[model samples]
Target chain A: MKMLINVPESVVPDALRGMAAAHPELAVDPDSRLVVRGDAPVAGKVALVSGGGSGHEPLHGGFVGRGMLDAACPGEIFTSPVPDQMARAAAAVDSGEGVLFVVKNYTGDVLNFDMAAELAEDEGLRVAKVLVQDDVAVTDSTFTAGRRGTGATLFVEKIAGALAEEGAPLERVEAVARQVSEASRSFGAALSPCTTPAKGSPTFDLPAGELELGIGIHGEPGRERRPMMTSGEIADFAVDAVLEDLRPDAPVLALVNGMGATPLIELYGFCAEVHRVLAERRVPVARTLVGNYVTSLDMAGASVTLCQADEELLRLWDAPVATPGLRWGL
Target chain B: MKMLINVPESVVPDALRGMAAAHPELAVDPDSRLVVRGDAPVAGKVALVSGGGSGHEPLHGGFVGRGMLDAACPGEIFTSPVPDQMARAAAAVDSGEGVLFVVKNYTGDVLNFDMAAELAEDEGLRVAKVLVQDDVAVTDSTFTAGRRGTGATLFVEKIAGALAEEGAPLERVEAVARQVSEASRSFGAALSPCTTPAKGSPTFDLPAGELELGIGIHGEPGRERRPMMTSGEIADFAVDAVLEDLRPDAPVLALVNGMGATPLIELYGFCAEVHRVLAERRVPVARTLVGNYVTSLDMAGASVTLCQADEELLRLWDAPVATPGLRWGL
Candidate 1:
């Protein structure tokens, strides 16, 4: 692997140490693999906690800060965190209000977060759970039992975190989180496969002139593999798949996300094509984000996600958010 | 070349269109290839203008917003913009306080910006220039007559832009820009070559299991090529090179920047090693940034930049700035 890591086993801990050092506002516990806001568990506010694997960074850990996730429990690369980590994080971030678990739709993540929630309840902590299954890529990929949660995890965290920052009750926050997840859909394409450090080789082989459509973030088999196509054609395919599962009447917030190794310029190009396709269908875009918000290790690809947005959700998304990965309106 | 672009020729304009659409706060002029603050020409503040090739997204264009460059003129990918674009940008953004040009050290860039400054002077606009030559990679590269400006261009624009935002005179702003350039040094590595869109192939050849150290941002040959080394050894080499040119007595602002295709997880791992080496040397880190701020398109590698920071520079760095690429303290 050409990755810049000390050792495959130590990548997560070392990265966490660096993250903690970079952002003083974050309190990172390497022992437990939990990242939380230094001033978390704010009184009378619902706390948001989310996590998955380590490879898709800036997702759960980088989103832990003011007006976003209150805490995150990161696992090893492409592996779900254990229940102990989640339970500890919940206990740490749960104020009198409650704690909301933003679990992605992978089997391991769902099981672990469920166990953690039960443990937290046993400890007299109010816990609510929202499962995000926004990916339209496949239903039951390698590590997932249902449609895999992808970019909408970020949307749910930002919107629900905004509602929580308003001192909303736990049920209200959970409802908003569910609403965001239900309103969203994502589809990804990969021109190249990413190598997992431990694996020491690419998870899959992508010949130089071929591409995979609807690939999962963990290098799971996609809907189809075809000879490489132009970016415009690929954008059309991804956007069409996402739009198929989306409601056309409501204006949407679009996220053109890079799956790791794609450059920003390419993302911008893909985003422009996405907007063009949406415009042709007369879909009003409420907001648009283009970057590597969610990613597979170093896969060269992009994903298109569309979330039907209402004024409330838009307000929540536009609300001040200060995190290491996504920061705006502070 | 595997890239997500529409047409090679239209990449610059198409990317700019997407940028303007994504960020309504910035004014984008496709006709002149300029990105400026939506509400520019602030009555009394010095206007900051910087630009170069278009491939470096968020460097010049994405940095055009509050507390950064008032205007950016992007040319074709990895090609210096013509004088007309810069002249028009300067005239558009210049307020009564005058304008300052932040030019990177490349023959084409310096010559074009100099011509543009002369043209602006003919129009009765006060202007000053600061040339950045902070890349410790090589004293001269293929496209540059001296040490090529790389990551430090961002530092110069940010710190100098902060001074200009505070209504500093043009000469003072230029002085600070030069100071930042002088105090900073950068070195990069590339595991693979970047293909220019027009070229339709990799800029250079690199055999598998090898890496280029001290590479220029534009795919220029580095100081040496060697077998691929572990991330720790690479970090040591890059940090040592940067520190050789950087004074250890002062607290330094460190930037571990990815060259487009490097993943955030790997960047964090590399950053951790950088901090470890700096700590061993007892070099205090005043501030640190880890991300793809400056990039070579789709190149899978990273660069390390260190700027010796004084109180003024730190204050400017800490000041609130809201641009699409870098946003914090706002």
Candidate 2:
């Protein structure tokens, strides 16, 4: 598989230990695989929690810090975290304000977070759920029961986390999370399939000279496989898919994210084309992020995410955030 | 080759445009291929200038901003920048105090930067050079005449930039840069070869089950090709190579850097093993960074860099610096 790992089954635990060693500000629970801020459960503030599979790194775990997720529950690669982990994280991080569960809309994730929320409520803790399903790639594929959540999960976490930090009520934070999800749209293209550690082979076969348009995070079947296209063409495909889902005449926050194994140089070129296309369509852009944020193990691809940003969302995004994966203004 | 690029020749320029678009705080000169802080050439402070091939994202370009390099001259992919570009950057960033050139010890880079420094001197600009050759992988490899410079370039730029920001003289900054370069050492391994854009093929070939120990950043031959080893064994190989060169009894700064294609999850696990080995050796670690800081384009491997950190270097590292790729304490 050409992967740098120990035993396949121990990847998650070993990485968690490494993460704890790297970032002293984060407190990792080896028992539950939950990563929370050292000073978590801020008094009188809403606690934001999110989680998903482990392969898409820096997603839920690396985002746990100031002005972002308060706690994150991580599952095995491409598998949903169990309810016990989420329940424990929720119970640990819930101050008086309450806790909000920001979940991506995949069948396993939704069901697991639901179960955890119920478990937390049974413990007399206030809880709310915000589902992110912004991928325009497909409605049902692989593990997804509906449109799978992709890059917009970052937007929901950042914007909603900012509101939570400001001591916003649980209901208000959930509303903003939903707003970000609705306003954002994402589309991805894969140049190569990723090999999971246990499998030791590619999840799917993609012959050379062909590209998968609108591919899902887990190598799910996309819109179609076509001859390799130019960077401009690929950027147009992703931006057009997003624009079709939601035409943004107002200023938007755009993220040109890499699907693991893609270099930053290519991501920058793709991002330039995306902005050019958006400008040609007369869509204003308030902020832009170009790098690998959400990834699928070592897949070689890129995803474009656009979220229609209002004043409040922009302000929240501009607020100070200090995390291992995403840090700025702090 | 599966890369997201338009034309092979346009990769550098297109990516520069994208970087300029993504980061408005830095000014990118399309003609000279220079990325510098928007408000550069601060009066009374020594200016820092560094550059190299383009594929190593966030190394030279992304490190340009507050408390780092004043300007970075980017060359073509895996090709050194011309003397003209370096000369232009040196002239532009000289704030009358002086400009210090931080050159990685590749033959092409050293020759080109030397010519540029002479040109800058003819223009009556005070300049000093600090060459980084901290890689213990090979004394002479493809494109390099001596020890190939790798991760320590980051430490030199960061620590020296911090000193310059404090209004230190040119000689003092140069001395500190040399100290950092001398104190740091690195070793690398690659699971797969990187395919250059122009070549449109892998730089080298390795069977699926084998690995290259101490591979160069540009796919140069390393110590040997051997059977794939476990992560713990690989970590030991790297740490042992570095420790052989310099044994540190004091607190040291450690960096576990991924070479483009490696996933962060693996990096964390690998980083954990590196720290464990260091702890076993009774090395006190004051700081650690784990990510793709210096990379070969989409190469699946990693490198370990350790620098003996004194109080001055630690203080400088902890100072607030804001840049596109590396940002903290802002």
Candidate 3:
């Protein structure tokens, strides 16, 4: 595969080293695979720590900074980080207030974060946990025993991180995180499968002229595969899947996220169709974000995440955030 | 052509419409194909107007907002925007203070921007132009009579726009734009070719297991295609090409930009290799940005742009600017 990497084994550590160089503001620990805010352990502030496998970049690690996660623990490509990494990050970033672990719904992630929470608690640190299972596409998937978390990981980090940054109590921060998680849902469709550095080939066979609807971020089998569809059709299906699962009465925060390799031009074009679909469905969108925020490695597709936002959630989302992936109002 | 688009003909307008919908802070005019700052025509401040072909998203259009371009004009995919679009954007954003046009070095862009300057001048608006010819790949290639302007367009717009935002005169803004262009040099490599919406096929053939070095952004022939090299080798080659001519006397601002379809993980790993090369060459980097900033549709590769920065350029780069693509500091 013609991918940009020295060797498959060195991908995560090399990238962490690069991240440290590019963003000196983050305290990157390549050995422990932890990326912590430069000024971590902010006095009395609830520290947010979230992470998952590598490959889906700018998700957990790229979201660590002033108004987001206090630390992140990235695992190998498409593999869960062990409990030791998470426990080390929690210890590094936790202030007197407490630590909150934002774990996605994959079985590996949930289990590891669970063990990490216990490990931190055993050390006299108060740790709260919230699992993000916002993907409406599947009830169970290849790596997940429940609905896999997708785009709402961003929503959870931003909204809840805002509360945490405000020096909210750990329980309150945990509540807000769970609240955002319950209010969000995501669906993804893939135009192409991605290749892992280790595998050096596409994860699966997705022949030309066909698209996978409801595909998981890890290229897990989706609801179905059909002949290639236009952007409008895909948006309609993805949005429909999300809205059907979450018949929201409140206005929504929309995320039209690129699955790694989709260009911005197409994302914007697809976003317009999403807006059209939402308008027809009478859902007022409070805020919209479009980009490769949470991504699979080089997969050419997009995921739609919608959070039914209350005034409080909107205010939280609008707060200043200074992460490498999502920066605004700072 | 498994791409995310409606009808190929609707790509530009659709994306523009989506841009408007997504960024309410920017006034996007679909009819005129312009993205203007929501608060335009700021009196007594020089304005920056930039535009080019449509496929490169977040370039000219995404750069339109506070502390950046006052407006951007987007043309059809892989095609130059006409004089009318640029002239209209110039007129729409120009206050009595005047407007500066930032044009890339492609022949159509330079020629049409020249015509647009005359049109705007005839309309009683002071117009100045700066052509970015930063690519060291070739002296002249498929779409240009000089080195193809690739990544340095971002540096010019950002540095010069910061100066303009500080109420600098049009001539001064124009001068620094030229200064930035002169100080900057870029080199690119491609693993695969991109497919345009209208063409519905790969722009050019790039056989598997090979790569083209010193590639122009539009899939133009580079120096040569060789069997694929590792990321370290590519970084060595790309940085060598840039620093060979730059030979910086001051610390440099480095932009390790992905040519669409390369993931952030790989970009960061590639960035580490880039840093290693620069460190060994003893070229100090003042700042580094890693992402898909300037892109070639969905081509898989990257470009390295290095600008030797003095204190003034570094200050301008650090200033607060809010835009869809690049947002930070206030």
Best by TM-score: 3
Query: In model 3 chain A, which range of ten residues has the least summed lDDT?
Result: A321-330
| lDDT tens readout by residue for model 3, A1-330 | 689888999999999989998999999988889999999989989999999999999888999998999999999999999999999999999887899999999999999999999999999999999999999888988999989998999999999999988888999999999999999999999999999999999999998999999998898999999999999999899999999999889999999999999989999999999999999999999899999998999999999999999999999999999988888775
**Which stretches of candidate 1 lie above 4 Å from their native place?**
none
The RMSD of every model to the true structure, in order and in angstroms, is: 1.3, 1.1, 0.8
Off by over 4 Å in 2: none
lDDT of 2 by residue, B1-330 (tens): 878989999999999989888888889976669998888778898999999998998788989998989999999999999988998998888889999999999999999999999999999999899999988988899889989999999999999999999999999999999999999999999999998999999999999899999999999999999999988999999999999998986799998999999999999999889989999999988988989989999999999999999999999987777777887874
Best by lDDT: 3
Model 2 gets an lDDT of 0.91
- Ordered list by TM-score, greatest first: 3, 2, 1
Clashing pairs in 3: none
| Candidate 3 RMSD to the correct structure | 0.8
i-RMS for every candidate: 1.5, 1.1, 1.0
Docking model 2 quality class: medium
State the TM-score for model 1: 0.98
How accurately is candidate 3 docked according to DockQ? 0.82
What CAPRI grade goes to candidate 1?
A: medium
Candidate 3 CAPRI level: high
